[model samples]
Target: MTTIAPSRPLTAAGYPRGFKWGVSTSSYQIEGGHDADGRLPSIWDTRCRMQGKIANGDTGDVACDHYHRYPEDIALMKGLGLDVYRFSVAWPRVLPKGKGRVNQKGLDFYDRLIDGVLEAGIEPWLCLYHWDLPQALDDLGGWPARDSAGWFADYAALCCQRYGDRVKHWATFNEFAVFTLFGYCIDWSAPGITDREAHLKAIHHVNLAHGMGVDVIRDLVPGAVVGAVHNRQVVWPEKDTDADRRAAALLDAHWNKAFPDPQLLGHYPDLIAESIAPYVKAGDMAQICRRTDWFGLNHYGPIFAKDDPNATWGFHWGAAPDDADKSDIGWPIWPAAFRDELIGLTKTYKLPIYVTENGMGGNDKVDDKGEVNDATRIRYLTLYTDAMKEAIAAGADVRGYYVWSLLDNFEWGTGYQNRFGLVHVDYETQKRTAKASYAWYRDYIKAARAAE
Candidate 1:
């Protein structure tokens, strides 16, 4: 593990005043009471049952058991000195059948969770969707269906009426491309299907859903901060040739700009607009473009693109250098690109930004002393966060930064193999052990507050 000392103190003086610092988690990733309290099956639940769908056959059926241990988790956040905690609400939990009938018990769970978050002096940043679509909705054709916009709008309106009074900050969706493209185009995620047309249609519907969600929240919750979290990659071409550059631009249009351009700018990038034109309705763009208060960006590292005429998307991922520093999941660590992405998004969107997710996953283990010494994760956080500070100094209006996770939880297709949390979790016993990175973050937050 490479440890680099901070050139200056890790204090609020290094960042803008009133900057928010926090951690993030999703419902299906951390909240494991899968069958508890009248919750119905989500698409992920169905996908987990399929043979060979998840790594090592591991499922989120009992992941971290956060549903039962949120009090302990909130205490952990309070101890970490977090100003906010960003989390997602499972739609299937509240609306078991996806459309009608409210589950009071499910609503009660989040009611208590938000109350607990406030009781602990941490603001709850709630996200409506985090890829755990209701299986009932999937049965009715899911995002590929044009009616998904109405389904999601109804869900959003219900949530706003139920919990929006207490929760002021809300995000409509998380990583539009990951769920739509990976789920529909590549068959890597839930409701796995391999159809380019479905992928394109899913893109339009999800964007429309986001816009409708914004409208619903505005109408239902007064003074609510509404936005969506997008995972934007700083794409680079494998070679500096015209063809490779064009391929990188095309990949950017599909992967990065497809969702945000429509939401923020009210139109798709010209490269893929015609490809997606067939599914778009007359007033879809009007609904897809809403007044988002902030842009939630989830970035990890840069993606290298290469020209591939034979590829389905006219581009293919190029391999990183063998010697490049990487996380346990083999994602290359490029802090410079992280800084670039922050600045680029700020320049393009011109909205106050929140880095909603950024962290490196590692194969962390508790040593014989019953302590986890994840120096690699600590280093990654320090470098990337410092990069974010640099981006802010370079004129990016970044308002907040949240680590990718709060606990070691089920990592989607990778299952529980990747640990990205400052707090380590023992899967068998459900023990929460704070790693060395946890202490580092605590002290950093303390210093930042003191400096402020």
Candidate 2:
């Protein structure tokens, strides 16, 4: 027993009136009907089929089984009393071969999903792309190809025509940098390539896709609240030296400014501007910089960077100090950095921000009495949310907060070793166990709204 403490009473904490709260989950992470109902292979599916790409040989072949059990999961969301539920639509699901032919079976799955989410009294936030690009599209050059933008736009049009009526909260993509950087440069994620040209091309094309997708959604879906989720984390130097400083600055540009800067501000950062210029044709910036409704920030913690001549882009991921505070998954935990990011993000972007994903991974274990009391996760949420409140008080126009996930599904790269969910999922029996943080968030939302 980790010594369960008494639950605290609700307090307003001065959160603004109608500060929305919810949870976020992606398609491949949870929905594991990999081969069912005309669904085809995504880049992730191809990666999983490759040897030694994912940890522990874990494939999302049966991840949390959300495809089969979403109704039960909707009941879970209803029980939580959320204002909205954020999830991504798998591209390969609706467009089995990327584009051209529509898979009505795949389209019908989301129809039922959106209907169930609405019936549960929770608004559905549909994200168009969460990096599960159709493998057929990858076969045709993936995000590195300029045509990928058009492909994504066609996919967006199909989704808008299908479920745009109920899904008013539309996000074009989720964590653009993560998928592009990891997939093309880092070789840690799907479509694992390490070519510099591929990385830059993927970055530009993905941003172009976002803008095109936004245009399609706005044209098709009336009154659509459109945004794109970007994982914006502060980049820290691995050391205090000039080499480390330069590396951190470049990584910062790629991590923070790559997609959002081009998509929102109309230009690439100076660090990679020249390198990416070859791919930029006339008026491409105008096309990439489409107007969006909100900025979806998916932040976790600060990322460390160091100069690496042998690594991609002349820099590689570095390590935090031995004594630095870390999450269960070894990610550095500095809620103050999170607080500062929120404030800076608000000032820089000047858009209503919604934290689409924020949560910590935990080593959740089912107790002997069939309970998962993940106190560590609860503490992480408290710290982050309190930091967010501080940012809100300091004049950040942050409207909503959605936790990273609803269930502990297949964490990319690390597999299921990292569990970032309010509800714990037992991989063995496919059981969903609400952790202590779930109740905490439920009450937190209640109190924030009650204050109004």
Candidate 3:
């Protein structure tokens, strides 16, 4: 048995007063009943139907049944003493065809969810997109087409008009690099299309859509705080050689700076400028560059890059040193790197930072007494939160920290194989059992609040 230490006070841990603590979840990952409430198919629903596309051939047909049991989930969030709940709204649910007709039932669902969140005294942080693009939009060329910007703006406008009164914190999109590069360039995710040119086009269109979405939300919702979330990574070279160093720099440009730089700095990185120049048009930069209220960062760990002359991008991801501790997903546990990444973002963007999504997937299982002893996850949270406190003390203006998930839902591509949740869910019965980590988090938040 893994022994968990007693909870330490956050003041002693150095977390500042009013440090927002919350949990995050995406729509398709948790809210199954995929065809519920007049909703149409998304790219992910289609992808899961393809042979061997998802692990174990598992589809999110009834993932945790959050669509029907959200009240229970909200109760779970309340129990955790969460200050906020960060969730994404499914595009297909709101607009079956991605445009033209509005689905009142879809809007009504979020209407109730938002009300429940507010009733629980937790702030609602709504992310407009979380990679579940409507299949209707995919049919119309999806993010690769220039028209996607308009489609996305329309969706955002509708959402703002309906939920704006309650939701003040809005994120335009989540992890553009992952969806564009993996979905279009590498063929790992939905609407998978492995083409370099298409990848570049999709990247530009997504950026345009983000800027357009921001404008729509600001125009439609009074007092709306809008921003975009990027899966930021600190790229490190595997060896002290010029080739590896160059590869690391290139990877950093594409993986880290590509989406954010255009949005925040109004220009593309010099390393990738020429390659993406063909798709850039006049006034696009001006449109992409908008004042954001905060910079949402979803960090996991650093990526080790190495020179691979034959690789499509002239860089390949290498394994971390064998001696390093790794998460269940094989991601390295590097808290110092996490701190440095936050400090670096503060130095560059000068916007308030939100650790929007940070957690470790664990090989969690229920014991005979029907409790999950996720001590490893608890440990991961402690170390990472401590690192975040260090970054804040080092001059990073971090306003909040939200763990990746509140419940064990469907993990994309990996299906339900990887679990990253404070509350464990039984796939067979849809039963939620709060793990040791949940108790740890609740106590930590209580201590933090009491200290304040």
Candidate 4:
């Protein structure tokens, strides 16, 4: 039922009954048991080893020590009154070498984490992949290899069979385009390579893997509410010049349409179809297009693209206008874009939508008073949530909202320089202090759920 009038501005956060509120965290970003208990290194671990790839010489080596302190983290989730907790299973942790040798201790760790989340009265949403591919898998050609799809399906089968009884919400992958585009087309992320053909192959292969993973989840896990998470946002031209405009259009295809259009609508985006044609076989779309329960969107803000003849695909990341309000990390803060993306996504994809990740990143530090008062993060959350409520009023099927992170852990590339969590973590002592945004989110959840 409609909770607010369509013509009015969003005043109060009165979402539909049963609206879900939660938080998200990834394995490599937070869980720091790298090399403990038969667990092997992921591509991210290898990336950290390279001399200059990570900032401040920071690594996730002991990040938040969430691997050992998940019980404490689960208490934080309970303290927030979360209805759900979204987390990913590190591939290397489960299959130390990507496949063949199953790590029992690795499996057991997730068992305890899942059980703890359940005991805290929160449902578990387990994402199978969150860009931490096993370094061994990268050695075997990573997502560019067609066989990688089979590897992912086997891994999904392992997870589904083990945890399907308790966990019903399964995401095949989180933000396919981000890792593929950044890793292959740019040197921003791991397994960094810059080749057009490699980028195309990675895109097609990852989409194939997602499709195969979905089928495996359905086959192995009964009552699975399966979906694939895509990082979607508006792509704008960096300048008014024709070159930048063309670059932005091409980037829009790669960033927004490449993954979801094929998986959901059964065809590749026009700009990408011809380039990816050489790799696609007959009926491959049918194989990749599996039935999913929801569209998981991880949106932050609009991206601008500039023409760069020397870059892979001849397009590069640009910046927001100088006057634009930005997060402390320089990410643009435009709630209208978030609102429009939601409304547009509902019309285009026609699936129940869950905002799997949305939050601000800051250079947060605990004050001398032993407290973190991140007032800027509170504003970002307030503006974004109000935009979301506006989207719901405009006929969007948005169901749940989970912030980007639950703790200030290791951010990739930027490393520990960026903090995107509501709860501030003192990386030195492993102390978890709830920030001002944490209290804001907790009360926001309470108020959103209590709305009539």
Which digits, one per residue and each the tens of the lDDT, describe model 2 over residues 91-210? Answer: 999999999899999999999999999998999999998889999999999999999999999999999999987788899999989988899999999999999999999998888888
Tell me the alpha-carbon RMSD of every candidate: 3.8, 5.0, 4.4, 2.4
User: Candidate 4: where is the Cα deviation over 4 Å?
Assistant: 1-12
Task: Please report, as a residue range, the 10-residue window in candidate 1 with the lowest summed lDDT.
Answer: 1-10
Residue-wise lDDT of candidate 4 within 1-452, one digit each (tens)? 23322332332565766778899999999999898899899999999999999999899888989999999999999999999999999999989999998999999999999999999999999999999999999999999999999999999999999999999999999999999999999999999988889899999999999999999989988899999888999999989999999999999999999999999999999988999999999889999999999999999999999999998788999888999999999999999999999888888898889999999999898899988999999999989988987788887778899998899999999999899998988888989999999999899888776664
lDDT for each of the candidates?
0.90, 0.89, 0.90, 0.91
Q: What is the TM-score of each candidate against the true structure?
A: 0.95, 0.97, 0.96, 0.97
Alpha carbon RMSD to native, model 2: 5.0
TM-score of 2: 0.97
What is candidate 4's local distance difference test score?
Answer: 0.91
**Model 4: how far is 412 from its true place, Å?**
0.3
Residue 194's lDDT within candidate 2 is: 94
For model 3, what is the error of residue 341's alpha carbon versus the real structure, in angstroms, after optimal superposition? 0.8
Give lDDT tens digits, candidate 1, residues 73-172: 9999999999999999999999998999999999999999999999999999999999999999999999999899999999999999988889999999
- For model 4, state the Cα shift of residue 324 in Å: 0.5
